[model samples]
Target: MFIVFEGPDGSGTSTQAKILAKNLEKKGLKVFTTAEPSKNILGKVLREALQKKYELSPKAFQLLFFADREQHVQNEVLPALARGEIVICERYNWSSIAFGVSEKVERKFLENLSSSFVEPDHTFFMNISAEKSLERVVLRGEKLEHFETSEKLKIVQEVMLNLAEQSAFTKRSTILNATDSIETIAQNIEMILTPMLFLQNIK
Candidate 1:
């Protein structure tokens, strides 16, 4: 199954993805963990752009994200799925829509760009307030990326919340309160997934 984690920067999606992957691996399941922009040349360029190394139009930036996603799915995600491993990714199609829309890009254009991508079997949206998100980023002591500001993240969170209710995501998405203790959130995810993984293993 393909599982994805989505949230604003500092919302703990990456941490949760890693924790879940590790827990699943310890249980003898074949698990593959990855994030976007992936570890590719295109991803490298995109990361630099995100860090403000150079500015690209919102459309151009989103396109780069799509390109990187295409390569990531074809060369990494697909093969792992074919091998029967559980694929857990941090950030996916939703990130593009949320971030792009927050940047004043057309939502329809973003959706069209993402139309050809593979949808995750399940998505976990780590919902957090903009204030809380900024607080966490400050605690991390890392420089903010392009979309890491309080105002931008507020809009991004709103966009993601709206996305969660859309037809494409409604049935397969779960929203978690990101302000909760990390262990509590992780336990909730493991509890929700354990039965499903058990059934998969038995098969």
Candidate 2:
């Protein structure tokens, strides 16, 4: 199964993804956990450009992200999934649609671009207030990247929610309230995923 976690910055997607992967592993499932921008050379360059150099235009960023994703799918995710391993990814095509396309490129073009990639079997969108998300990021003492501002993050968050609601791929998606306590959120995710995992085992 391929599962993707989507949300804005500081939305606890990383935290929940880790928890879910560990729980699945403990269940004796073969699990692989990864994220994007991936650790590949293309991904590394894109990550640096996005955060440190700030030289990437919106179209450039979008294309770089997709390039990294193509490499990621070919190198990591698709292989694991083909082997019937449970794959968990933090962020995916949805992030590009929300942040890169909506802000800079046309929505229809972004949708078409994303359709070329492998869609997740299940995606979890962690919803949180933009203000709270920004606060959490600042509290973590992380340096603010060009796209890390509260305003931009809010727009991305809204776009993600909207896209999830409207997209056919999101029929398998679950929206979780990310403002809740960590334990509570984890429990909610487990509740949603465990049954599906069990069903897969039976199949």
Candidate 3:
């Protein structure tokens, strides 16, 4: 099964993804964890651009993201799933959609770009206020990315919520309150996946 976690920069999706993968591994489940923009060459370029090291128009950046995702799916995600492992990804298609729409890019174009990629069987949307998201990022003392500002985070969060509602038609999605304690949030995710894991084992 493919499981994805999505949210703003400081929404802790990365942390939760790691914790879930760790715990699932202790249970002896086969798990493969990854994130996007992936570790490939194009993903490296996108990461640099996010840090203001490169200037790209919104359309250009989204196109790079689309291209990176194609490589990611082919090179990493597919092989893990082929081995019957549970794939847990920190970010996926919705990240592109939310950030792209927030930057005023056309939604249909973004959707069409990702239409061929694999969709997650379950998506967890970590919902939090823009102020809270920015605060968390600042507390980490890391250099802020281009989209890490409070105003941009506000727009991105709203866009993600709207996307989450629309996503129900495609797959299972759960909205999580990211302000909760880390352990608590992980527990919530474990509860959701435990049953699914059981069903998979039986099948």
Candidate 4:
């Protein structure tokens, strides 16, 4: 299954993704865990530009993200999924749509561009308040990235919530409360996902 996790920064996606992948591996299932703005050359350059230099126009940023995603899909995601392995990605096309639309990109164009890519079989939307998520970021003592400000993060959070509510992507999406403890939240996600994995195995 192509499972993607979406949320604002500091939403514990990385932590949970690791735990879930490990648990799945323990079950004797092959699992591949990765994230966007991947560890590739193209992805690394864009990630550095975004985080350190803050050097991309809104349109350029969107395109670079998609480029990284395209490379990631071609080189990593598709291969694992084809082998009947579970592919857990930290972010997917929805991240671009949410971020792009917030940057004033036309919604229709963003949606169409994103739809051209493969959609996740199931997406876990880690829901949290903008204020709370920001606080978590601060507590982590990380340097501010281009999207770190309260204003920009608020916009991203709003876009994510709005998409979760209205986008067709939500059909295969599972909403998780991110404000809970890590263990509780992880358990909740596992409860929702374990059955899906079992069904796939039977088929």
- Tens-digit per-residue lDDT, 37-91, candidate 4: 8999988888787676767788888888888888999999999989878899998
Q: Model 2, which residues run further than 4 Å from truth?
A: 167-170
Model 4 residue 103 CA deviation in Å: 2.1
Sorted on TM-score, best first, the list reads 3, 1, 2, 4
Model 1: lDDT to the true structure: 0.89
**Index of the highest-lDDT prediction:** 3
lDDT of 4: 0.83
- lDDT per residue for candidate 3 within 35-154, as digits (tens), equals 999999999999999999999999998999999999999999999999999999988998998899878999899888878898888999999999999999999999999889888799
Q: Which candidate tops TM-score? A: 3
Whole-model Cα lDDT of every candidate shown, in order: 0.89, 0.86, 0.91, 0.83
Record all residue pairs in model 2 with backbone atoms less than 3 Å apart, i.e. clashing: none
Ten-residue stretch with the least lDDT total in model 4: 162-171
TM-score of each: 0.95, 0.94, 0.96, 0.93
Arrange candidates by lDDT, descending: 3, 1, 2, 4
Shift in Å, residue 125, candidate 2: 0.2
User: Candidate 2: lDDT over CA atoms?
Assistant: 0.86
At residue 80, give the lDDT of candidate 3. 95
Alpha-carbon deviation at 6 in model 3, angstroms: 0.2
Clashes of 4: 0
Error of 4 at 131 (Å): 1.2
